[model samples]
Target: MKAGDRIRTVLLAGGSGTRLWPLSRRHCPKQFIRLLDETLFQQAYRRARLHSSPDEIVIVTGSAYEFLVKNQIEELGEEVLHDQVLLEPCGRNTLPAIAWGMRRFADDPDHPVVVYPTDHLIGDGMAPVVLQSVPLAEECLVTFGVVPDRPHTGYGYIKPGDALQNGYRVAAFHEKPDSASAEQHIRDGALWNAGIFLMTPRLFFEECQKYAPEIAEASLPGEYSLLPSISVDYGLLERSGRVAVVPLTVPWSDLGTFAALHDASRQDQFNNVGDAHLFDTSGCTFIHPEGKRVAAVGVSDLVVIDTDDALLVCSSGATERVREVVEELDALHDPTVLEHRLVYRPWGSYLVLEESRFFKIKRITVKPGASLSLQQHHHRSEHWVVVSGCANVWIDGETRLLPQGESTFVRAGAVHRLENRGQIPLEMIEVQIGEYLAEDDIVRFDDRYGR
Candidate 1:
């Protein structure tokens, strides 16, 4: 590495983790969900900070997830600058996402860029290992290859050729193989592709232009809609001659499916992993977000996932096929596939307590100092009862402070807003009476969150 050389970390956070269904949805992906106390995205942010500065780290995600990404980052006690976050108009796959993030460093073509997917689980002390490839970044596009502990068929494999100082030339890139092929690849000393890359902006763009000109061209003007949905491995790395692989010893897992989650999770005495009460369940995994008690009798090698709207019970080996269930749900237009019963908003969040043909009940909580949009419903009228804290309620341009046990009403087509200016969170119970209770009924005159 040179004295003036720089490195930037890019976190790709736009995946809709389909295999971790029920727990992960389209609106709330696995990266934002708390598997432990902290989220996977926050872990990725801390890992990126080890290799680059806060300003040098960039996050590329869809526009719909911008708030969730920002909120998670802020939870780590770090502030994200507007320039550091690149919002894609839509999901265009990894090639376009990486290309868009790489464009921000066009002025500094010599600087090396490291890309990390936000949903993966990686161990600590990765800074030294990641920084080791900085000097190699000048001549080759570097990718980290994990030393596989098992012959797993779920991940792609990377074969290394001519050895370099800290890595090797990428001899070949193999897609996910069957059990026999995975075992053969393991015997041949193939490494698991971790999907982490380190390359200079000049080399990345050059390779993109050489192999994927459409993506390269569309990326320049930010016209990603016209680009093909392809991965960087198939589009660039496999086609480029400058690719190299760095062997990584740090523990890692893609967590692509429930099986992977089971492998990485902590097991109890019966080899079960989860926060549920178990009876005779051996070698089983149970996941419940609501702390509900789940007792199983004589269930072994099974996976049980319970959510508010759906329940999944499958064998441990069948977790990868969870995508089929999501496809079926999408075909039926199930709201469970889009979001959970508890939906997060920019100000706070709301829980769907009950709903029927003509009425809907919700428990709304607004964060301190946060306010809702100044809006009205064309098809509905709302009744709000303050449960705790103080509510700064506005109805038809009239504002008043409603404390605990106070109530207010808003008629249809009347402009209204809710704000929490107190030091604590404002909690309220909202009842809506309407012909149509869908979210599309709102007409915002003004919004603080740019809804």
Candidate 2:
């Protein structure tokens, strides 16, 4: 490693958060949702940018979320090149994701890479700890360890061994423990595994090859699907000898459950932390995402998360088991288990307003200068009524401009497209009559986004 070498940041954002269900789903995870003023991805992006240049940052995400990744980075007013984003064909877990990014930095293996989970939150005190990891990255695989304020059973614990120059050697790695075990670990002065890793590309890839050969051998995107799904901790750090833990002097939370979210968010006098209209509700967190008026009558120590299609009501302590609810929903083939009513796209977003056996209604928003794919639906005919802005509609090679209140009909099997040519967003109501109303029914002729 040289003094002039600059370190880059890699964001591992492919995990599907199951604990934060109803609000988080398979298609849209917690990192992408607008939790506070901006999404956690935005927050993580800003934090990562603090240490690396925009061009130096790499985002490893699932293939389905390629556009969401780009859109979020675009919202930050920074350009994300196509090569800057690594799209996984399917999730093979963190080890593969980090190794894929490390492949890109193979030319300069000594160049440091700071890895962060895009869904986590870190305080300003993390700045010094992160800066300290830069030099430590040259010598060892560094993982930031947070001192446990409480016996948090949700996080993995790190046992510190021999003392290092700036940190400590890893004595052992513990999985999420029971109440008694967690308390014991705290008594032993264990650190919470923060999952933030800083190491050089050569060190990471070498560690992966040594310990996680199955993941390290797969270089192609298609081959990654065949690799076993394993976390970095299980595959490398826990098994490798070249590991060190630096204490993080900052407030941090994985925000993996509703209880953690509640603890992180500011609460009212009643200890509520969401946008629900409470009625005699105290010590309850009501997360009504659709702005539906939720009346919690005399509830305490409860979590009520309401989406347009699903409602989750559980005890505060039971938030960890919410994944079981998602499992049951998946077993029942519930589409609501995967996405919200309002679905996001690269061009913009669309909200499913109504649906029936043969028809579906949607409110679509097209961003300025953005256009939908030039495609034809096999089983659906669509009627679009413009609500705001201007739309340049193309049907069967014929173009027609539609202003607000104007409508257009797209016949079944017609090659049609919708574009927003105006300076503002184009809002339209779409009513579809179809035999099969699904996203996979479209056959695209051309797409600017290379979908």
Output the number of the TM-score-best candidate: 1
lDDT at 48 for candidate 1? 86
The alpha-carbon lDDT assigned to residue 421 of candidate 2 equals 86
Give candidate 2 regions above 4 Å deviation. Answer: 1-6, 276-280
Worst 10 residues of 1 by lDDT: 217-226
User: Model-by-model lDDT, in order?
Assistant: 0.89, 0.87
Assess candidate 1 and give its TM-score to the true structure.
Answer: 0.97
**Stretches of candidate 1 above 4 Å error?**
2-6, 219-221
Estimated TM-score for each candidate = 0.97, 0.96
After TM-score superposition, the amount by which residue 326's alpha carbon in candidate 2 deviates from its true location, in angstroms, is: 0.4
Measured by lDDT, the strongest candidate is: 1
Cand. 2 TM to true fold: 0.96
Residue range 1-451, candidate 2, lDDT tens digits? 5433457889988888888998898899999997667888999998888778887888999988898898999999998875999999888888888888877777888888888898987777665567766777888899999999988888899998898868988999999999899999999879999999988988887888888887777856768888888889998999999899998868888889999999989899988887776778877887775546666676789988877888889999899999998899999989877888889899999999999989999999999999999999989999999999999999998999999999999999999999998999999999999999998999999999998
lDDT of 1 by residue, 345-387 (tens): 8888899999999999999999999999999899999999999
Q: Give the Å error, residue 324, model 2.
A: 0.8
